[model samples]
Target: MKTRYTYGGDEHVYVEVDDEMSLDAFFIGLSLSRLVREANIPGVTEICPANASFEVRFDPDVIAPDEMMARIKELEGEAQAQEKRLDTRIIEIPVFYEDPWTHETLMRFRERHQDPSGTDLDYAARINGYDSVAAFIEAHHSQPWFVSMVGFVSGLPFLYQLVEREKQLEVPKYLRPRTDTPKLTVGYGGCFSCIYSVRGAGGYQMFGITPMPIFDPEQKISYLKDFMVFFRPGDIVKWKPIDRAEYDAITKQVEEGTYAPKIAEVEFDLDAFNKDMTGFNAKLMEALNDA
Candidate 1:
């Protein structure tokens, strides 16, 4: 598909790579955004990459809108010619599936969910072609997810599973948003998965909770020392299912400032993954397991 360039008001420029969500579109946005950052255009103030598109905020006085658009077009061409790989890190995030807290929260807002008669996991499992919640949970943890974008909150990560389209899990959001969502709540909406950074209002289907904090204003955690946000656009996240006992242990470690998450550095080749997802994901999981 061709990339569409448009102006966002008078100070921002937007580039849309695809209408549908895909890894290729995400990588294109990532590549162009990185190239634009490297250019260090004087007028550009911020770069925001989304699921299948990216936007740049610029100072119109320093650089005209037309000039910025031209520069973006140039960068898009450059990105197409650049390497197909992106430097990324693999993070193993621990999750307690069917956890009590998230389950309670969902139960409290059952009227807001599409399937008011059953729990969110039950509804999700049925729609995803799984016979039971256990099988659904297994599918979720069976593959690694790519952090396609980090937004909607300070550190909320929008993840896309690294699997073929046919194997992708899909779910719908709640009919109405919940007034309160616990911090680190693992939620899913449409075709994407997300980890709520803080307790607040949300509409995604509640699944479970992670003990670790992805966002810390104080940055006390060693892993978040470089950046308060634990994830970036191209980061790979693997969710591991843990029991309540292990979850409590990790929570205690987090409280004591002694817990360290498993993390590994790896190069993600978008082209290779698109060509051979099964093989690429096997290697990706190996890297995470090695970590």
Candidate 2:
């Protein structure tokens, strides 16, 4: 794949690998980004990998822009020949579908939603061809979603499911943005699903709430001691549906600082996923479940 390199003002370089979102594009970007970080160029400050693109921040004075560009192109070529494998982890996130907090928030913003009369889940389920909201949640949990990008907020991750494009879920953003979305709100927009890390203004249709914290600035959770945000661009996420009982129990644990996310490291194979999605996903999930 040819990468289109462009300058971001005088300090950053943006490299786009593909025009559209796909796991293939993501892997290519991830590989190149990883190599760029490993190079540890004198001027490079940050490397951010996105859905189909990656960005690098650098000091032009220390390393000339032209010099860095040439190095990046060389790394891109090397990445193409390397195997498409990622050392990542799958995290199980528990969500209380149609929970009261988000339900109230969605009801208040119905006028902004596509269907003013229906709840956010009802509207999403109907548009996605599901007969009921419960069926929609079931379908959502059936497939694992890849964390293609982690932005828009501190720990908010934009998740793309590992399914054929035809089977992907799609939803429209609100006609108008909501002034406030509750923290930990699970939302769906376009072809991506997201968990709102903080309470803020957003347009994605709100569906549920998770008890676990994805962002803790204070590093309250042991897993997040190194970084407040828990997600990486290449991570995998599986949303586990829970009843109010489990939700409340987890909330209590979180308050007491006893809760920890269930996580398992796995090697993702891009070629195998492209050849056989079902088999690939089975193996991916088995690694997490077995651990």
Candidate 3:
């Protein structure tokens, strides 16, 4: 893989791991970012890792831009030499597919959708070659997703499916961005899935809503007490579909500050996963279930 190094003004350095996005490129960027962090290079104030690239912020006075780039290049070599494995956590998020909240929002923005006559779910199903909406939803939750990036809103996670490249789900965003998307709305665009942390403007196709809160400024929920943001880069997510009753129950617990997301610690080996995605994911799911 080739990497492109560029300066983001004078205080930040932007590094592109590859010209295009891929799981390989993402892992390389992730590994490089981890190396940068562990190196403890002085003047490096912040590190932001994205899908296929990463950015580093530093004080120009402490570390010259040219020197910072040199250090990162060295770390990049080290990153390439290291094994592609990460100790991460897999989380189970309960979702109510085709839930009424997002349904109402999507209906209001039909004119901006690719297929105005049909619902987003139906349009996605037909385009993806699924016989029914249930099958489409099943395809979504059946495979685990990786948190490729987390942004656009505080604590909003952008997820990429863990299946092979051909099996990945792809959807187009709304023709025009919507003025309102319900909070916790599970949205999909391109090959990524996102949870709208707050009700705001968005362009991704709304699929459903999760009862759990991904972000909370007050940090009132038991799970969120330590940190307002619930997700981090490299985290694995499994979507678990739930009915209205379960949704309501979880919502009640959330309001009472008792809701906690299901999470289990696990190790992810890129090489092993690439060799046998099914077997690896089954093991990951087993860990989640056993926990």
Taking all chains together, the TM-score of candidate 1 against the true structure is 0.92
**Of the candidates shown, which would achieve the greatest lDDT relative to the real structure?**
3
lDDT of 1 by residue, 190-220 (tens): 8899999999999999889999999998988
Clashing pairs in 1: none
Winner by TM-score: 1
What ranking emerges by lDDT with the best candidate at the front?
Answer: 3, 1, 2
Total backbone collisions, model 2: 0
**Tens digit of lDDT per residue, candidate 3, span 1-291?**
799999999999999998766878888898899899999999999998998899999999999999999999988877777777889999999999999999999999999999999899998888888999999999999999999888888889999999998888889899999999999999999889999999999999989999999998998778888999999888999999999999999999989877778889999888999999999999999999988
Q: Worst lDDT window (10 residues) for model 2?
A: 77-86
Candidate 1 local Cα displacement, residue 236, angstroms: 1.2
Pick out the ten consecutive residues of candidate 1 with the lowest summed lDDT. Answer: 75-84
Give Cα distance to truth, residue 142, candidate 2, Å.
1.1
For model 1, what is the error of residue 225's alpha carbon versus the real structure, in angstroms, after optimal superposition? 2.9
**What TM-score, over all chains together, does every model reach?**
0.92, 0.89, 0.91
Task: Put down candidate 2 lDDT per residue, 33-133, tens digits, no spaces.
Answer: 99999998899998988889999999999999888888899898787777877789998899999999999999898888889998988989999999999
